[model samples]
Target: MQDDALFPLLSALAAVYAAEPREEAGRTARHLLEAGPSHLGAAHANDAILAEMAAALAASDHPAVQAILAGAHLLPWGDNPVAAQAAAAGDIYVVCTLMGPDGPIPSDDFRMGLFWQRPGTYYALHSHDADETYVIVAGDAEWTAGDDTRLRGPGEAIHHPSLMPHAFRAGPQGLLALWRWSGDVNTHSYRMLPDPRAVAAA
Candidate 1:
């Protein structure tokens, strides 16, 4: 029953990503959709912020957002491995990998996923070998890449090249975004850089 519900939601999500004008993001999502799901294990993770995420999604009119809201409970939600290792208060967000090497849909060199962060939470600077793009599905955030920062809301897309440092601070309503990874997709190269706040406090 769950599998029946999940695939359509994933297809809706792929459509959402494919609609992006950015070449890399659109191509990666379409490729994964064509490859299809492997129907892997039913893994789940616990996080306090998921409720807030769902509430935010409920306010969105986008079809993809509605699709995720309908099937969010069926997704294999989990803590980000790098966030688990580096976060000060343990896991601050939840992720659902719909496609990747380890996700239900298998892809060797790319990944597609959803991410939700708690309200007003700050994800410090981090970098990894894979190139990444995040498409905001609901809520808002202040995103920083190197010396620049911008307030991004729903339907906005942010791209980060391999190893380019980036960070996010979720807005009052928190954040819910779809993200994709390409190039070197291995998480082993992920690193948490020095928090700028800590550096400033020193």
Candidate 2:
């Protein structure tokens, strides 16, 4: 039987990403759809892999399955160590990796990364698996390049090549963008800047 219990979890992830850029939303949505529902594996509490998978499915809709998922809940990366740094220079961020369904059964051909924004913040200079793209929504956002800076408003799409240097800042108000990856999610590159503060101050 299909793991219908995972449906609600997919819904929660989708809800959290409702305002994401089209590409990001599409990437994440595709992952969710692909993940579908599955038994996961032989039950093992405290297993790091199993734990993360359960957290990803924690928000499931099916009551019974949700109960199983409810065993532990790790809120989206916030000011938390693993994530605080991701949006610290900025205001919001959400990155989703296929942390569940173990083995070739739940393979990681690609991953989803979505970021939320607050005005006066920058996602900073960094790189990650696959080339990157963003769909802008909500407030205005500015992307900076070594030679120039481009400011974009709602409904605009931007692209960056793999290992290329790029950064972003929300305009006068909070912003939201969906970020999609074209290759392996585990791959990442971060540009070295003389001053991270400069990136933030910009």
Which ten-residue region of model 2 has the weakest summed lDDT?
Answer: 72-81
Judging by TM-score against the true structure, name the best candidate. Answer: 1
| lDDT tens digits, residue span 1-202, model 2 | 2244445655544544454455555556666656554523332222443343343333323222342344223223222113422535322333333232223124354334334455565666665435666655345667775445788765566777666667667665545444555554443243434446454465
User: Per-residue alpha-carbon lDDT of model 1 for 1-202, expressed as tens digits?
Assistant: 6656666777887788778877766777676667554463575755355578787887776668867776777767773545545656334567777777875677787787889877877887889998898989898888997778989889887889899999888898888998889899888888888885635422
Candidate 2 Cα deviation (angstroms), residue 199:
6.1
* Model 1: lowest-lDDT 10 consecutive positions: 81-90
How many clashes (backbone N, Cα, C below 3 Å) per candidate? Answer: 0, 4
TM-score of each: 0.87, 0.52
Q: Model 1: which residue pairs collide?
A: none
lDDT of 1 at 142: 86
RMSD of 1: 2.6
Candidate 2 whole-model C-alpha lDDT, 0 to 1: 0.47
Candidate 1 vs. true structure, TM-score: 0.87
Deviation from native of the Cα of residue 32 in model 2, angstroms: 3.2
